[model samples]
Target: MFMNIYPKAYISSLSDVKADYFKEKGIKGLILDLDNTIIPWKAAILQPEMADLLKGYQASGLNLCVVSNAFNRRVVGLLEPLGIPGVAWARKPRRKSFLKAMDILGTTPAETAVVGDQLFTDIWGGNRLGLYTVLVIPISKKEFFGTRFVRLLEKFVLNRLAKKGVIEIPE
Candidate 1:
């Protein structure tokens, strides 16, 4: 169960991700979590740095799609100008939305990766689908109420993974 929830990589933020690294790993597509992963939770604006990075990834030939639990309006508001496709109210940790994102990318699991701030949703869901998972620290402390509860459990799991050397926790 723990292995199933473990992420392939853990990083401070999305800015750490490099298109070249994914290319080397044969990942042609990216399934991204929108809220706290790309922007602050519930934020409609995409930061200039993040926007540039995402554009850079596209320029590097990586297909990208946002799979978000937020409402359709929220997702559309943020991604439309960028011309990125997305699915809203994804109910992730479930495989359906993840599969749908892959279909949109036209890439198989072997050629895809998932990047998000949540372990239960993003990491576990992506791992279940056999896609590489990269867990990033949430961009802000603000999030859904339910997510706060999940974060408690996530902390425990992260600590355990760190002690077992499955991953090294950042100080």
Candidate 2:
């Protein structure tokens, strides 16, 4: 069960994420999942509110970076103008890419938080690496074929945790 596996998991929405939350939580860096967490999957354009949210984090002295499994240049290119460096092909659920992002941010796992929409990849990877893990509802329910399959598994895990009262679903 995800609860037995990772006891400190949290589920939230991108809009609900506030700079003060991170500050109060003592997070100095953030490893953000680009695809549905920051923008809709396969969408090249960033929403204005999303951009403002990222800016808010930056303004609060928090280091932020996109850590995505996306390998396409087009997908990676979209984030360049945001003025933050990113690590594409992150291969999440694997620790190497998370470590690389941490190295780039010049922070340790203790001082970092990983925010993403997927439970298996993002949350698992972050928790395994000892970073605070936050799971956000995907911006869009539509997903790629492979991602849809992973989401099925993620839902199973979430359900199990919820039944055990270890994971609370956000309102």
Candidate 3:
């Protein structure tokens, strides 16, 4: 478990995620988390910035879909205008949702990347399924109590990586 594994992982800010970066990394498809990753958890509407960014990625020929654990219809509604179909009640960390997203995108595991803000749900699930994983800092620190607890573990992992120089915290 302490193996110095080569990272099929990366940490990035939401603002720093670019189409070119994905293209350069040879990622042909993206599986995105909805809440906190694209918008704050409480937000029912997609921010214009996120809409534009999604358009940019789509325009670059990157297949994109929102894969979220949220079962809310409002969450699914928000993604429709972006013309990207989404899967809610994704039940992530379970492999089923990730596999479903890949099926929708028509891409295999090697061609896909999963982008989200949580470690337990997003990273663990993606890594398990053999898709490249990107862990973004949550847009808002406030979350459900259970999520807050998982976040504590996330910070522990991040801190350990920082201390080892395996990952550098942004200035």
Candidate 4:
């Protein structure tokens, strides 16, 4: 039961996971979370360095799509410049959006990965479809009020997972 929310890997940030690493894992496509996963919470700007990293991933032959709970304008505004498609208002931890993203990427579950900061949304959503899941530490301390409440529970779960050797939390 606990494994459902557990990610296959956890890292400090998106930049830590390299293109070559994804290639080695046979991941040809990625379903990325927007807000905290890509930019800081509620922020639309994608840093130049992050943009370069994303472009490099694309250059390395990985298809990318943004799956966000935010409205269309916000998701599209940020990703349009990067030529990345997105599914906004994605009610994740549900299969529909993830399936839609897979369709957009034209990749099977085995060939795709979902990267995000939240376990309840991104990780759970990806795991449901057997997609590789990578949980990144939230980029900033600032976040939604509801998310702040969930983070308290998320921390407890992470501690348990770490103690069980299911994942390693950095000190």
For lDDT, the strongest prediction is 4
- What lDDT score goes with residue 148 in model 4? 82
- The lDDT, on a scale of 0 to 1, for candidate 3 is 0.80
Q: Predictions ranked by lDDT, top down?
A: 4, 1, 2, 3
What would the TM-scores of all predictions be? Answer: 0.92, 0.87, 0.89, 0.94
Best by TM-score: 4
The global Cα lDDT (0 to 1) of model 4 is 0.91
Candidate 2's TM-score: 0.87
**Which parts of model 2 are misplaced by more than 4 Å?**
1-7, 168-171
Q: Write the per-residue lDDT of candidate 4 for residues 57-144, one digit (tens) a residue.
A: 9999999999998999989999999999999999998899999999999999999999999999999999999999988989889976
Report the poorest 10 consecutive residues by lDDT, candidate 4: 162-171
lDDT of 2 by residue, 43-93 (tens): 878988988889888998999888898985855687777888788888888
Local accuracy by lDDT, each model = 0.90, 0.80, 0.80, 0.91
Ranking by TM-score: 4, 1, 3, 2
Candidate number that wins on lDDT, 2 or 4: 4
Q: Identify the runs in model 1 with alpha carbons over 4 angstroms from their true place.
A: 1-3, 168-171
Model 3, 109-168: lDDT tens digits are: 988988888777787888887887888878876688877777787778787776788753
After superposing candidate 3 on the true structure, give the runs of residues whose Cα lies further than 4 Å from its correct spot. 1-7, 167-171
lDDT of 1 by residue, 53-107 (tens): 9999999999999999889998998999899999999998999999999999999
